[model samples]
Target: MEFELWYLLLVPVLFGAGWFSRSFDIKEKKSVADETQTLYKGLDLLLDNKKDQALNSLVNLAKIDPDTVELHFALGTLYRKRGDYDRAVKIHNHLYNRADLSKKERARALFSLGQDYLKAGLWDRAEDSFRKTADLESDYKVRAIKELVNIYESEKEWLKAIDEAHILEKVTGETYPSRISHLYCELTLQCMFFKKFDEAAHYLQQAIHADPNNKRALIMQGTMLQKQGKLDEAVEVWKQVGKISPEYETLVVASVADTLLKAGKDADAVRYLESVAEKGINSDSVDAAVDWICKIEGPENALEFLRRYLSQKKSLIGFKRLTDLRLAQDPDNKELKELSDFLKNQIDKTVRYKCNKCGFVTKSFQWQCPGCRNWDSFAPVRSEDPSRI
Candidate 1:
């Protein structure tokens, strides 16, 4: 019984040696009591709203009792929460450099230091600190990795961003297809700017592999082919965008038609535009398509096509288009032409593309919402009056 009791008592003593006072003596016991009293006083000061005094007391306690790792962390956290990143970094750096800290405590201190650096806009130092904080068993491992990923993204290190994106997906079991795909698209942009068509195509393919439904990747691929003077191939590649995201047709239609025209496929372009209209089109896109038709097939043919379409489905937009076309054909009629121009301007002001994610309105289509950074968040069909020019 004596041995068992001594063993039980010995465990806490050993734990305390690691956790608090390292020596089991009268001097160390008194030191522990003094430290405890100081901590209590600091808490009292904090409760009384004497923030500076409380922090000073806590700092003194940390200096006297280097074993009080948790106290240092709390102080650093308080500093960081109060936006005093310099002070937080100093406290965490002190704790981080201590030789006696447990691995988890060290990780915590390092993470705190990284956060200080991050908040201070010290990206390079923050990356280094976060890297040190990464431990498989530590609670901050995933968070550190994610911070590193965000750093890579902010720095535009697309390849490193892609690597972390994979790690994050595996660790969280949530695929970041769009994010991964976009990173590849960014790479493709760089390669294209350098006139490395093959390299750009490879990145576009990687993007497609990452997310088959990534319309931007497809769009980039088409752009790459067009850059290579493969107009037919470019048009074919761009047509895939409509299949992947039908709502994005408005964005891709002009490119596809232009590509078809360059490839001597004017009839194909007209048929493609007609097929697009068959599905549905906003007033602006339809008007733009009619402009294309007037240029390619002739204004008379464009007018007849618009008349037939408006007969089946009438909208204010189509009506406005009809009046404009009629007025253009009879430009000598000054009063009628003036009325058409007035109505067209009114329609232009009222019809707008709006971001469904953030309600940001623009006159032009945005593949990614500028306000919210969300892709395909703008409704395809809703052309409400724009909030901007």
Candidate 2:
């Protein structure tokens, strides 16, 4: 009877232990499920325009799951956008320094840190960051190298820029011919500034070889040749600029014409400028035509050309130029003086140049746009102003 009683009491004790174990298991699973749901809700908040609350929730998630690399990346990007470079740097730096990071993740972190330093204008730090990223043999390495090129260009480290460009081309299979040519041009200019004409000429040749159509190189080469008293060779080289990029030809025509004139090629100068003026009434082209006409054809013929040109084109600048020419031809003509005054006021308020990329207008020309920071964004506007393209 005592044995039976003990068995009955043990049954209840075992049943109670089983129930406790099941309850603990359920509670533990519910806790994990709740944490997962909270993380999902945080992502929802980020998508729903509640960034502050979303960030707070994400911070909580980070605290709970500190090993989540994706969450860290998102947080770091957000901090970077918020202009908290220090925090972004800290997160990315932490990820980069982690021994547990995969090669891919480490590369990503390095790239991000490099961009962070770039935005902060810490060029030295940025260069170091990008250099480390460039060493990693990953998909991001090519991009890292490009960023490094941009950094070196900004810092005026042209040699480093050229090296990075070469690396980028080798790795990415993309041609940076124009950019490479520009780099060589910059190097040439640097050499020229120090009166190293031989080195400058070598760099200019390299620039031309990099991009045969690089007009800047042709212009510089022509100037160099002229300085060396090889006037005929210089004139021939400068003339090619017009054939290659006719749109930009207007720039070189006048300078080339002047050189031709000084070299006793007066007929060639007149013929070239006239043909250029007939095709485009742009400021550069028209100015060249006017300069030639005033010198050879007399002020009267120049004024006549301006009038005939304006009759077809109707440019405000052309009108202004004509008005000036008319006033100069007949200083006592009251009507000409009055017209010039009115046109000058109109021209003064006009936005002469605009960026093709960002549509930012400027009164003066800018090679690199102040608004978008794009190189060669501005083109000398002619009569039919580019409203948009």
Candidate 3:
């Protein structure tokens, strides 16, 4: 009987505790409503084109609930976009160090921090944050790898750039021959600057292995061999370029001709020129080859060759060469020579190389596009387009 009375008395106390818990639930719901209303107000301000005020309001709201992951990320992204990298880093770093974050959230936070650091020019810190993303098994792995490639490139760390490029190619299944080829070429340049001819040669070989069609590698290889007094070897490598990439022969024709002359193969050089012309050839190459022919054979022969070649395929450069040669042969004709000179200048402007990727125009060739920073973006101008001007 005493036990029953105690049990009956405890029921009202349990009921009172249940009532208090219900009241707390209601208060929690009200708190959620208030946060939602504040978020709506922030959005309203943002929609009014008051971005600074919106950010301030949202940031203040975020301070009230620091565990709101999306809010922090959005704010951090906005800060970074506004060039406030310190605030971006602060927000992202705070999120990155949160022990309550899941694996994916942690990766995302680190990725953001990495971007902030990179934009802030903190290469080492950016690399550290990106490296942390590797262990997270998120898509940030690929993103981090790509950024690391850029970072290494900016820092002139070619070996690390190559390593990261290979990993990226493997992971993303996308070819990076342009980037890899340039990296190897960069290493070759560094080696050659230090008088490390053998190392440069090795890197050139690696570059060719990475991209056999790379024009820079082919030119550098031939140049290196020529510097080492390997005239026949240089001839062979440059001849390979002529055979594979005839359009690029213009860039290396003078070197090949010199090599052939050094190796006592003048006849072979002329024949190579003839062979390159038999295939499709650029006008500059034709101009150069005809000039070479003038020195080797005779001016009459060069004139004959140009006339016959120009008859088959007409071009401004061909006309210019023909006119110049005719003008040189007859200096007494002042009016004819001046007209030819004026035409040559105009044609020279039109014949300038242009970057296919970025439309960056230049008189000389470039292995990389300066405007877009893309490798092999420039191509030889075959014809004039007045519209581009």
Best by lDDT: 3
User: What is candidate 1's lDDT per residue for 110-144, written digit by digit as tens?
Assistant: 88899999999999999998887764459888899
Residue-pair clashes per candidate: 1, 0, 0
The worst-scoring run of ten residues by lDDT in candidate 1 lies at: 380-389
Could you tell me every candidate's TM-score relative to the true structure? 0.67, 0.85, 0.77
For TM-score, candidate 2 versus 3, the one ahead is 2
Query: Model 3 — which ten-residue stretch has the worst lDDT?
Result: 380-389
Q: Which model, 1 or 2, shows the larger TM-score?
A: 2
Q: For candidate 3, lDDT tens digit of each residue in 233-284?
A: 8888887876777788888888888789778999998887666555537777
lDDT of each: 0.80, 0.82, 0.84
User: Which candidate should be chosen as best, given TM-score against the real structure?
Assistant: 2
Give the alpha carbon lDDT tens digit for every residue of 266-345 in model 2.
Answer: 88887877777777637657866887778876888777777777777777678778878778879999999999988777
For candidate 3, list the clashing residue pairs, or say none: none
Decreasing TM-score order of the candidates: 2, 3, 1
Stretches of candidate 1 exceeding 4 Å from the true structure:
1-83, 95-105, 298-389
Lowest summed lDDT window (length 10), candidate 2: 380-389
